[model samples]
Target: MSERKPQVLLIGFGGVGTIVSYTLEHLGRAEVTVVSRPETYDSIKSGYRIESCSYGIIDNYIATNVVKSTKEGYEKYGPFDYIIITTKNIPEISPVVDFLEDCYHESSTIVLIENGIGIEIPIYRKYPKAIILSGVSLIGTTLYEDTVKHIARDIIKFGAFINYNLDKQMQYDRCKHFLSLYSNDNNFAEYEENVKLTRWRKLVYNTCINTTCALTDLDFGRMDLFGGMESVVRPAMKEVVAVAKSEGVEIEDHVIDEMIRGEDGVYYPPSMLIDVRNGNYIENTVIISNVVKYAKRNGVPIPTLTVLDNLLKLVQLRTGEAKGRFELPEKRPLPEENYQIQFKY
Candidate 1:
């Protein structure tokens, strides 16, 4: 008899979530159930039209099952073999540990396909015995309504997150099994011996390009139009490398140039920029502030990152104010001369 397929529960069915679910179902290796927010549940439940450069256009793509919340997912599909979270790593708004309360089990392996460094710490602390796999995806995909556009790369590097509570060999074995199910010809996957280093490498881009674009409200191509590559992008990336070095992660200077060249002419709206446009809180803490804290602990100076972090905090404040998530005293009205300055332009 054929072995039973692994049962998987995936949370946050956005661009990354959609790609992961589609790939798992497309390969016919796993039984996938997704937990999406109530707002987008109906739309996603109907179907998705995926325009993928790697896998070609796929019409009416749907998962094995779709549910609204983690509670519903757990009640319907309990004892899941793998619980994958591809949600935005906004701990203040939605903590990662909250999602696992209902679904997580002793046998369940938690897979984190989210961004930012130090993302797996909280989960590891909470579920010490659970085997956690960190997935670093370099794919550039965006979801518009019911359509998902996989524009650029499709690569994911997976490694077992360091958990002293669990046996190292067992964690690696689980990671390898998941890799076998996820990787295919077009959707490339590789094993990473040191996932923390991989995360820091990706942060070299996220902390620099992603934050810069959100602050300037520019796409990849447009950022280059204003000489941001040499002025802002590269400098911030160098700071990231410095901080990583202090933590004993060696990232060569050439990686910076290679990353810049990779998106040389592409017009891509990074996830952070998209959040800004939608009046959503930017991932300031995980993506930027965490690195800043690291730099401080090791006495590694990161002036560029410091400036970026401060600016992003202001951006986050603006988003919070716009969304009414923050309550502040009414602003004093501007003087008549302040209004008149607009006409001078």
Candidate 2:
């Protein structure tokens, strides 16, 4: 008798998906299958290519299997060991429960490698028996044309999502097994005991830089060139810390200084900015609105975040109307708030 390799199914094959798949393949830790869009699936079927600054170039790294949707994937490769979702955390627009409902099994653990806090609540509501994990992704990646590119390296904080609305603990066995797949220094993967606290820490950077750059239609390098670090960026980043504290998640004050370091200023565009420019749905509800929701519930005042939230909602409306992706380049002005203090409840 021989040992069977772990069976891992990822619901997306974009930048994050490709990078994670490559890492898993290199380690020979799992038999990786991908559920991709029609276009991405076709591309993979013909020939899958990945370009990376870290791993050089891989022309054809064969996957175990590639399917178009979760239903198809489940029918073919049912009862996976692990399911990793790399799509955006947009519940209202594109609920994950739709695709992931059939994909999870009794023993399958789902890992989310997307951005935003307050994202797992809905999933917990749908699948009470399923174990979910959050991957606080800090790595820099981009999907262009048909290639997945890894521009820089960072860490992914992994922890179990025991409760929907609150932070607590469950069996650490699954989490430990997942982390053990990678070497200690391989790709900077870490197991986080307090995942919610880590979520808040990442939020300071995402809520501030991602929303601002996304709305302004500017990259980090352009923001540096225009010089808004102390005036705009710092204030926004500082506000996140306050909201996190009100929610009982204490992020050190000095993180603002660390976030403002010079090296972070680069030509890269954050995920939100890329989503907006591509006419894709922005993650306003989960990222910005949820923070405001928690802050108001805790009676914490985040005037700056309030302004940013409102401004973003209005911009999101225009984006929906303009159909930014299909709209002509010239008409879609290469540029761009909302203030609403309400919860999804």
Candidate 3:
């Protein structure tokens, strides 16, 4: 057996893959291979370049390798120990199945770091023997050529579900392994047993931020203070709480209110807003529709979310969204008193 670094296979060489790969590279312990679409693979293999304000300038054409499809991807550089998926939700599950069918073994671990809630159960039911992990990523990275523009300083949450009856020691071992990868970095990773609850919590935040941001065509900072937009956030949050409560995800009404009031006032743009700005397909299927489905299942009325969902669908239909153009913004301005005050929560 060869004594070599652990091998990592990343599906979709988008922003998430960039950040994860950059981290893995800096950690100096993994051979990272990114599997992208044919068009993207060509671009990456030639040389990857990510121009960003945060990381100064990144050009990774030399180190990174990209291939198309799981079969070719695995054959060229895999039998990977870890597969991290950062694609949006609609096609997320399918490629995972393809990766598993073509290359992965019983020991390979799959980590999903995309938007949406409640996707894991279906994936788990089908791949009962596979090691499945779910996660939330706060780091933002976008692709420019083969390199990824990475915005550091974000937390990542990872773990298995509460309903999973897998061996506790195995779960702990997985957590330990992941932490070993990132623990030394400034931003930390935490593993939880109640990953479902964690997913729902992040979902609520996304439901409010993503829907409103896309519909109103505003980033977080603008919507947070937009008189008309901020007014709608509270009511939307009320509906989210009602639905979440029905689903047994306990979030205090006040905390929900605070989240909306706080996040909106600051200027962090959601992925939906970015996608819309860039003329990409909106992720309405998973975020907006799934919330409505879960609310209906629990007999909880989420009128606000439903209304926003419908409005966003109309916006997507009429405008035909796209991904945001990667123009690095000027330096962030000093926070105003209100902005500073709102973020205290």
In model 1, which range of ten residues has the least summed lDDT?
Answer: 336-345
RMSD of candidate 2 to the truth, in angstroms, is: 5.7
Give all candidate RMSDs, comma-separated. 5.6, 5.7, 11.4
lDDT of 3 at 19: 64
Model 3 gets an lDDT of 0.68
User: Tens digit of lDDT per residue, candidate 3, span 201-318?
Assistant: 7777788778888877898778877763457766777777777778778876667756666532348778898888876666776677777888999888777888888887666544
**How are the candidates ranked when ordered by lDDT, highest leading?**
1, 2, 3
Tens digits of per-residue lDDT for model 2 on 178-250? 8777434448888887888988888888887888888789986676577766767888777788888887788
Tell me how far the alpha carbon of residue 221 in candidate 3 is from the true structure, in angstroms, after superposition.
2.8
TM-score winner between 2 and 3, please give it: 2
**Residue by residue across 1-345, what tens digits does model 1's lDDT show?**
989889999997878888999888797899899887888888888999999998899998988888887788888987888999998888766788888988889989999998898888888788878788999998888899899999876799999987888789888899999999899998889999798899999999899989999999998778877888889989999999999999899998899998887545668878899899888877888899999999999998888999999999888767766776655545654675353211110
Error of 2 at 241 (Å): 0.8
Which residue ranges in model 3 land beyond 4 Å of their true spot? Answer: 49-65, 91-100, 162-165, 228-230, 263-266, 314-345
TM-score of 3: 0.80
When sorted by TM-score, best at the front, the candidate numbers are 1, 2, 3
